[model samples]
Target chain A: MLTEKRNWGWHVLLILIVMAIMLPVLFMISNSFKTLQESYHAILQLIPAKPTFSNYLTLNKQINLLRMVSNTFLMAMIVTLGKVATGLLAAYAFQNFHFKGKRLVYFIFVATIFVPFTTVMIPNYLVIAKMNLLNNVIGVALPQMADATGIMLFIKAMGKIPASLTESAKVDGIPNRKIFMNLIIPLLKPSIISVGAIFFINSWNEYVWPTLVLKDKSSFTLPLALQNYISSEGGTNFPLAMALAVIMIVPPLLIYMIFQRYILNSISTSGLK
Target chain B: MLNNNSQIEEAVNSRYGPRASRKPRRRLLPFLYLLPSALLLLVFMIIPIGYTFYLSFFNWNLIAPTKEFVGLANYVNVFTDPTNQKVILNTLVYIVLLVILNFILPYFISLIVNFFIGKMKGPYKILFFIPSLFSLVVGAMLFSWILNPVSGPLALFLRDFGMKVPQWTNSGAMAIVVICLITNWKVFGYNFILLLTGLGAVPKNILDAAALDGVPKWRVIWNIVLPLNRGVAIYVFILTIVQGLQYVFTPINVITQGGPYYGSSNLLYHTYLNAFVLYKTGNASALATVTFVIFLILLFIEIKFVEGRHKDAD
Candidate 1:
């Protein structure tokens, strides 16, 4: 059809446009390797001339980057586990049960997705503080335990498991819990992993709630730690900030890369569905 | 009442049903599973919303031993205060700019990439989506440095031609614009993917059929593509305005903190400032309640719109 030759025009223009769109991210990676002097003076360079690892050292010294990374990882893990567990149980109930007031209960859980965090930020902070969870990772993770999105995603996932499989298991006198554990759980592995990735990334990038609770630098998540570099005084140290930025982006980026297809596909399909 | 109902049910089960004896416990199992998520939803979400309302009626500095009930005075303050007036206006501006940058921009970009381009949409999508995964804190820092008027890369490039970069962070309106730009960069690709995938659902032969009849490309898109993809379009439109409020918060915090005399502050950030920094608990709650009402109204509007579109299609 000669479509390949005609497509050359489209490819050339898109390549240039995408490069412009991607320049900031490219700069973010490149500038992390530069000295403070070159970062300021050689501003447009896509690659650093004299690269150094000193920025990483300074980042560690200034804020103990490793500690923040661990704190964030722990917090996200707890939150993701909590969401997935609750979501699985709830989704199983919704999928299998014909309980009274099920519609009301489903709406109650699913509707929270529409409730903006800002409207409830103050009360959530007060509640966390009252639990004596100030300056704690658990404080950041607790209120986020039951996510409605995970419930919605899981319900859609469970709908795909053929009903006859569960029905025959029930006929054999198998309890619902065992059926869930053995049959549904293994079948729902892909959904769990993709949903887990979404929850983990959301929790990892969470800044507002963590900023409210984790005031101590030692307890801060990576996004909150960047706040130290963002204030007027800390903005002067460009290279270290870039280094910290690079460090802060890596875990979520890695998760995203590894789970990219499943993640994007499920998000789009679930939203449209 | 509970004892009477169960006693009656036990009598019925004894009389008629050995299998029915297990029905009560079976009904109870689902509730037991539903309890944990429901309890969390109550504590973290439902109860907090109610608490926000209760606090809105009382004046508290959060340091004091007692809260004095003022009853609607805090709501009055949110409405009467000049700073809050500016913040409410700023919130409206944010909705507009966010819709433009996040929704409309991605709409056109998705159209171009899907209709005009031929191959390897996946790779381009991945490149754009790569930014969406990172923290907006990173985006805030990235844009602040790149658009820095003086030593930033953009400034340095423009200076070679004796051009000067605009000092965006210098003013309140410009600060808000810059914040919107930063979020657009972070959010654009995801929305692009959504719309493109939605567009991909339109039958290719319909477009080709229209084209063979000498119909313009825009006609085919408007008549065929847009009608089919309205679901994703509406989802993205509301999402842009709703989630956009929160997305702009990080940039506002990292860049402006609602500074230059509450110039760039929107309703959400203003509420945060009132609660935490100023410690005006009642005032913040009032603002929070107002923001909630606004969001509810937006949801109501969307429901209405979706129904109306459904009727027209029918």
Candidate 2:
């Protein structure tokens, strides 16, 4: 009897915990279906009595929703591709090649992680302005192109690649560049894919830097666009804003699901190790 | 094993006309690989830190561009001012509460989830992890409604029970605490996922051995699982500390706007306000330096502890 009660208690707590975790998301989805009048009503209703697509339709027409989605997608892809290419190259060098200042350079790069974005935001803005890159997708992509996290992941992934393969390639008169291109890159495919997914998601969701740099409405990323919409036009229109939220969330969610197998593998390995 | 010069020399001679011709190339490849990141660090990362230090020493303002060096003036003002001190204290309290909740809540959630792992874990993990995938603006906005004093779910429940629903965001102190709760709630799934991975890394044989020795399941968790997953604990703590500092900006900006009065103002948002809004670049730089130093010390301590324990275990 006592054991049964304990089991029941555990199951109840687990369900409650899961509910607590999911309640907000469920509420947001439900609210998206709610009418403005219904949402603003004093009573909280789990189910919307009058479901409508007006909020969603308004979201599509009023906000440049598709443009923001494409803009975010393009920028994230550019940044992800740049990081993978550069990160893989650097990691291959560190793993297979030995030279002076290797440890020092690696340490310097790792140390970059400590310097918070706020410290660099002012100067980064200045640098971007000097390059005439402000209000451009390239501006958003440049700083993220060589992230330390990708480099670290690549280095760790490449380290796990056996040295025998590189030695064998060298014995066959393979050039250093060729070895990196043909051998190291292939071996690090999983790492590249995983890091690319993470980088893409991060870039897609990035807000502050874009908020600071991009002043053009046409060039606005999804998060920035949604934020602007919420603060300005969508204020007090919780249903419409929730619809916008749903729209902003869908692409990343789709991308996440597509690459979920790699993501889970990478996350489990990266987190545990 | 070419852990020495001979293999490199042989490769050098084979690659180029001679060993002498190859020397510079060998010396150059590593630097060449690092050049882009190093230059980026110099221009964007390192110089910015130096510029922050320089700005802190001057009476720099965005509005008034007459930069005058004030030596230790901003630093002195930041340290000596009561309001600045309160912000620092509040930031520390916020971080401590965040670290505690982020570390503990997720650990148990992972523990509970591990009980029913095989069939439903994938969907369960995704369900739990989805909240973290939302942007801070959305999360904060959603929670703001959830915590609304009048018509929110909580308030409505209280109203039916004939109890007054306290306005959480109206008061400064409670506002900060509620922000921390919301922050923790949003992030708990991420840590839970991480902890589950750590728990999965524990060898099954060790648990089996403990069970055969008649050790209770609780003891097995305490003695075997917890000790082995120390790395996850360290990682979680370090990440929580850094994220905790960075995230104070979101709550400060969105929920309170740094207060009913500057009550919930943590260091980062305060620095931002000083830099852009109020145009006290000097004060902002000084504040950034102090916060950076505090973070560096904490990171150093965490590294030392982890390394010491690791070495002892090995």
Candidate 3:
């Protein structure tokens, strides 16, 4: 009887914590549907008294929300593809082949994770400027494409494949490239999916670098666009800013919902290994 | 069949001069496979890091035609500046708070959820992790809206409860605390899930045995569950440090711009302010170098301590 009572108490506590965690997200979505007056005055209400689409409509008129979303999508896709390709090639080399300085090279690549991007932000900006890629989405995406975490995760996944599978193919006179493409690539579907999703979400959500590189309004990614909107116009336009925030969040949230299992798996597997 | 195959392989190898003919081409193949990533990393990561180090010794505005070398003056300036000192203190506080909230709190939360919430674990996890799904800028914006004095739900709730909600942004220490709170809210679920995975690996039989031996639940957790998952704990620690720098960047930029008086700014934000806002490339590079060295030491410790134990266990 005492244990049952204690269990119920724990349940109540957990539910309360969950509500606190969900509160901001719920508030943002709720306010996005409110009118300016309702948002300002009905702040304590969970649901808007009179829900309206005016905030979103106003946002559409003031800024190119569609363009910003598309820009983010394009940059994310390109960067994800680049990182996956580079990660796969490097992982295959590290796992399948034996070469001098292999250990040193792998160590160096892994060590890059420790060097936070902020440390090299200035120099990278200079390089991008020199190449005349400033204000270009390509410049915003290029520096971030070389990801150490993606490569390391791919290496870990590749290590799990049995050596005999590759060796038997080699003995049958299959070319290395063919083996990698026809045999190994198919086996690595799960890792590819998880890693690609991570890359996509990360690139989609990237802010500081894009903010630094892209100055043109047309070139603004979603996060940058949202930041500009909020800082300049968000004071009086709370509902509209909330709407932009909702738009900015939807893609990543969708991806997260769909791939939560893979993401969690990837984190644990990479960390524990 | 095995003997015949071995004889055939020996004959082929002998004809090819003990594998040398095939080995030379294959030796280059690995490098070919590695070249793309290596070149990109060299250009983007390795070379830039070296250049950042080089730039730290000179004084230059990025647009200037000439950069004058000043040796360690930039480093001295970083150390002596009062504003920079506050930034350093903010960063240290952020890291310490993150270790408590992000690492320690999540570990315990995972344990409770795993232990008590039997069937609701999946749904609870998804709910908790929802905040992290949003982009950092979006998350910060949402919090800023919620913390707005006039229109924020938080203020309204506090007012209803007859409590005063302070002006979070205008206050220096409170601003940093609020940013940390927002960060922890967004991130704790991620670490919780990671810790749950770690906890799942703890042997059930041992727990049962401990229970059978009359070991208290707290004792079982403190002695067995924690020690068994030290690897994950250490990983969580290192991640907190690394991410502490990155995570606060967005919030500070969006919400506070590093201050009512530079109280919320950390090393990363300071680097940005120096480089972009002030156009002091050299000073920014010097600060970056210092931050880089500090993390390098932390990373080295992680490798030596945590990863070393991991390998031994494997």
Candidate 4:
């Protein structure tokens, strides 16, 4: 009975911490639906007196919010697909085949994980510009697709596959490509999904590179659009900005919800490794 | 028939290359498989880094026809400039605060979440981790609303309680603190999840024995669990430094613009300002090269200390 009481105490404490952490987010959502006056009201209110969709309407009318959403989604999907495919092929080769310079190649690939995009931003921009891809979504997505973290995670995941399974297939006259497709790819589903989800979230949230590369307002992703909106409007239009924030956050949140298990599993396993 | 049989045998032997000779060619297939990714990395990552290094010595505005080679002049300017000094100081403070908070707070939170959350761990983790899914720009904007002195909820609540709330964005030190808070809010969950996994890997038998021996819970964690989980702790430590430096760029650009007299600008943001905004590609490249060297040093240390330990244990 005493232990039960202590447990309840801890539960309440944990709940309070969680609430405090989530307050800004909750307030954003609540204020997003509030009238402009209520959103700017002096007193804090968790629930709006009268909820309205006017803010969302304003965002759509002003910023073409739907277009930005679709743009972000498309960029994220392309980047994720590219990263997954490249990461999988590279990981499979590293795990299955012995090459003379395998160690050196692996080192080069893994080293990029530490090389923050900031360090390479200027040169990458120049390269992109020279290629005439400036202000293009493809340009923004292309450089981001080659992710070191994705390769590392995939390699770790592939390492878990039993060597005997592939060896037996080989002995039975199965080719390497066929084994990768028929056997390894099937086993890699969870890691692939998790890695894909991670890449998608990352690309969706990416701000700095896209901001530099993409100059056209029409080519803007959600974060860039929201930033422009804030700078142009300043702080006066609180509800409208909050509404935009909601739109920017919802997709990644939904993705997280759907793939929470795989994401968490991958994170934990990667840490252990 | 005999001649035909010998010819077939010779063909098979030539093709197979006597097994030993086959090994060399077998190694080439992996290289073929690795070509696409390697090419991408070379073009995008490796070449860019080399270019960054090369640009550090040149006086170029990125569009100018001739980039005059001014070898090490940009590096000298980076060291001597006062604004760059402030940026470096701000970056150091940001990294220190981030490492401490990110390292300590998340560890404790993980402990609580791991030991105390019980069956509700999943729900709790999801709730805490929700903030991380938001883009840093969105988060900074959201907090800007929440921390707006005039119309913000916290200000109003404080006023009602006869307390004072500082103008968060206008002040320099306070802005940095606010930025740190928001960053911690968004980032803590990732490290928490990492530490929790580390704790989970602690040997159950040793923990049970510690409990039986009446070793206090804190002691068991500090002395037993922590020592055992050093690899993860170092990993989290390195991540805090790396991601912390990178994460501050978004908020500074979006919310502060290194505002209130450049209080929040770090080396990364400063580099952006130099290259894009100010069109001083030389200075920016120099700064980037310096920061890259710092990162390489940190990575080397991690490899030597953390990964080196793993090797020793094996």
Candidate 5:
């Protein structure tokens, strides 16, 4: 039940709170439409009186926005696919198999979750450079292929699947492969979406690794493109930077807005699990 | 009826046709399934840690063809460096600031929305969550442009009220605070949602019964809600300490570059600077080793705590 003292004061207070959080975002969206000259002339203007697409055009001129955006999206998709596939298989193996060294293998995989990427980042960079893939999107995505948290999540989701369901299928003369295909995979469908969406967003928003790997403007991820020439700036660059940031931010925001329940629920569930 | 385990076992055993005759078929199957992830872990994570430690003992700029045997020199320098000392101190400061901004403040914010205000909770949550969806880089850039200390929108906005905004980059302490706020904005709502879920999971009946007994709200929240939500609260706590430093890395790079005499730099950003900016691979490796050890200790404690809980449930 709702609180008894839900007075008019509460609604007003809530709206004010919402606006405080939202105004900066509104500020970002509004400024993305401004021209460089207008942006410089009125830095405090939330809404550009004469909005123009010139900033976005300059963004493309300065950096290959189309190419970078596509590359970033492709990188996200590849990493997400790799994580889900590897994590699913690994989780399934741990759930069903009586193999020797199972606990040790599981421990090794899960322990990597605690291994912050910063520590191993240098060596990983060296290896990638050695592979001559410094500016490659695959190089950026390669080391991030196996997400330990995703494996752990899948394992937890799988553990919740009743063992008797698999056993019943076995007694009914269903083959092991068929049982896995029809029963196990279907039951894991919800978790698959949860992990997949999480992985996609994470990979999409990833910056540090890509910053290290993707050096060329053409190969730059969205984050890289936004930050590429930020330091050495003139009047034109800030508006262009704002345009790139707006482009970079929209998809993830849309993803969050549409599938927030899945994203948020998965986080709470995975954190506790 | 539930004790039909023996019969089910018999059926499974017999269905495979004589357990004694059964062999470990496809014994390598599970290994095959686990291969892709294991190899990635070995090459990417396990080997790199060992490699970083090995590099710490050598003096070599990344491009230099030769590496001199400088045993313990990098470690000594990393330990003795005044800038590193400040950064080490800055890390603790980061943890305190981050926990307050990202963890504790969000706890009360959620508490108000869930228990106090009680209206438009869903809409409020979605709006709050909006900031978290954007990349930390975007957030840092946005804040950097807005809070540029001169001619930025915020400075201009405040000028109308005869107020002056601090040039945050000029002071180390202020820079750290500003960067933390950038992180807090991006992370606050996500933590809010996680914590609110935890707070909401406290059984409503318990609170209702306490209300009937005329038990004060603080007593119920203090004695009851906090304990029930302890697991999640701890989860967010560890997350803040572990991931918070990383989140600040973007802003630190974009805004300050660990500037104003390295005031805003943490160990992670410092390590990045030493390795990439200065190409002091040895020093960075040593620093990275130190970071690895601290986090490992935390992870082990977590493993022990979680294992104990699982044992209790079993």
Candidate 6:
């Protein structure tokens, strides 16, 4: 009887934490369709009386949601491709080749992990301005592609591949570039997907860099556009803003839901230690 | 490749032989492949860090033709300024509170969840981890609408019960504190999943032994479970601290803008405002330098304290 009671206690605690985590999301989704007056009614209910799609319609018309979505998708796709290609090449080099200043150079890259991006915001802005890439997707993607963490992660994953694979390839008269592309790259797909998922989410969510660099409203990502829309209207359009918020969150959430199995498998095995 | 005859010739003639001689070149390719990463670190990371350090000593602005060095005057002024001092205290308090609450809460939650391994666990983990999938920018925007004191869901819910809901983002210090708390929620799932993975690694036999020995449930948790999971605890600690720095960005930038009255700026956001908003590149650089030093000190402590334990355990 005592053990039964204790089990119930743990179950109750679990339920409460789950509730705490889910409460905001539940509230957001529920209020998405509620009328403004009903939304502001004195009771916090999880259901709406008259659920409508007008807020969603209003958000689409006002925010240019489609263009922003396409821009974000295009940029995320480019960043993912660049990160996977360059990141894999870098990792293969670290794992397969022996060179001078190798350990020292890699450590230098790792050491900068703590160097906050704000430190480089001014310098990067200047560089982007000089390159005449402002308001361009390339400018947005390039800065993000300069990712040390992705390179480091890929290198660590590559290091685990048996050295004999490379030796056997070399014996077969395979060139280094061909070996990396044809042999090594296929084996490291899981690592690529795992790291790629993280990078995709990050680039999609990025605001400050994009905000500062991209001056054109049409080029703005969802977050920036939504922020500007809300602030300009003095935040009065609660229903529309909430609707836009739902839209802004959907893409990354969709990607995550689809790829979550891969993410979990890779992370559990990677020894994030 | 070397000729077949040379392999036999070299094998007989040399101490290291053909294979040993080829080892360095093989290792060398890995480093060459890493060259682009090296250049990026040098250009983007290392040089910028050094520049920030240099800038901190001067009253540098983008518009200024000449930068005048002011030694440690900026640091002294920041430390002495009542407003700046309060911001630092508030930032530290928030970080400490988050580290304590976020780390232990997830560990215990994972501890309980790990006992259920099949159908129940999969859906439960997904449920808990889903919200973390949303980007911080979107999550912040969503919450801003929910927390609006006048027209937000929270305010409306309060008014129905005939209680006045406090203005969370507008009224005094509580606004900044509440915003920080909201930011903490977004990262909570990521930390929980990480802890769940760590807890999953513990040997079930040992736990079974504890149970067989008639050990009390709380005792099993305290003595058997917690110590074994020290590794995850350390990992969660380090990652949480790092995430804490970036988390302040959304709250400071969107909801508060470091305001009702400069009431919410932290070291990183203050540096951002200086560099971007004020265009005071030099002072901002100085501020970045300060933040970098603080990060270094904390990182060193984490390495020495947490990572050192892992090394010792291994």
Name the top lDDT candidate.
1
Task: Give the runs in model 4 whose Cα sits over 4 Å from its true position.
Answer: A1-5, A232-236, B1-25, B116-119
- TM values, all candidates: 0.93, 0.90, 0.93, 0.93, 0.91, 0.88
Residues B1-314, candidate 6, lDDT per residue (tens digit)?
A: 23563465466549766566665545565655666666666665677677677777888776667988899888886788777677677668667766766676666677777753222567667777776666566566666766666666666667779987665666536755665566667766677778778777778898789888888767887897778777667767766766676676775687777776667667778778878888877767766777777777766765565566577568
Off by over 4 Å in 5: A1-3, A6-14, A40-47, A172-176, A232-236, B1-22, B304-314
Write model 3 residue lDDT over A1-273, tens digit each, in one string. Answer: 224456777788878879888877787789899988887777767898888999899888988888888999999999999999889989999999988999999989988888888787887888899999998888998999866788799888888899999999999977677788888889998889888988998889888789899999999998887787565123746778779888877887878778888876786677675
Best by DockQ: 4
**Can you write out model 6's per-residue Cα lDDT over A11-108, one digit (the tens) per residue?**
67767878877887777777778777777772377878778888887777776788998888888888888877777777777677666776876666
Weakest 10 consecutive residues, lDDT, candidate 6 chain B? Answer: B1-10
lDDT of 5 by residue, B1-314 (tens): 22373365467678776544224534766876788888888889999999999999998888899988899999898779899999999989999999999999888877777777655688877788888778888887777777766657888789889998886778999989989999998888888888888777778999899988988777888898887777677777777888898889988887788978988899999999998999999999999999889888877777766565456445
In the range B1-314, model 2's lDDT, one tens digit per residue, is 32454467567678776646656776787766767666666777888888887788988775464889899999998989887898888888888888888877788778766653333467667766666666666766676667776556677778778886677666778878877776776677777788888888778898778778888777788877888888777777777778766765665576677776678888877888788788888898899888778777766766676676577467
Q: Judged by DockQ cut-offs, is candidate 6 incorrect, acceptable, medium or high?
A: acceptable
I-RMSD for candidate 6: 2.9
- For every prediction, compared with the true complex, DockQ reads 0.58, 0.45, 0.61, 0.63, 0.56, 0.42
DockQ: the better of candidates 5 and 6: 5
Each candidate's number of clashing pairs is: 0, 0, 0, 0, 0, 15
Indicate the TM-score of model 5: 0.91
Q: DockQ (C-alpha) of model 3?
A: 0.61
Each model's RMSD to truth, in Å?
Answer: 4.3, 4.6, 4.8, 4.6, 5.4, 5.2
Q: TM-score of model 5's chain A, to 2 decimals?
A: 0.88
Cα lDDT tens digits for candidate 3, B1-314: 54684476567778886556467768888998888789888888899999999999999988899999999999999889999888888888889888888898888888888765566688777777777667777777777777777666777778878876677777778888888887888788778877888888888899889888988888999998888888777877898879867888988888889988887889999999999999999999999999999989988888876766677567
Rank by DockQ, highest first.
4, 3, 1, 5, 2, 6
- Model 6 TM-score on a 0 to 1 scale: 0.88
Q: Which candidate do you rate higher for TM-score, 2 or 3? A: 3
Which residue ranges in model 6 land beyond 4 Å of their true spot?
A1-5, A34-38, A41-50, A232-234, A269-271, B1-28, B115-119, B305-310
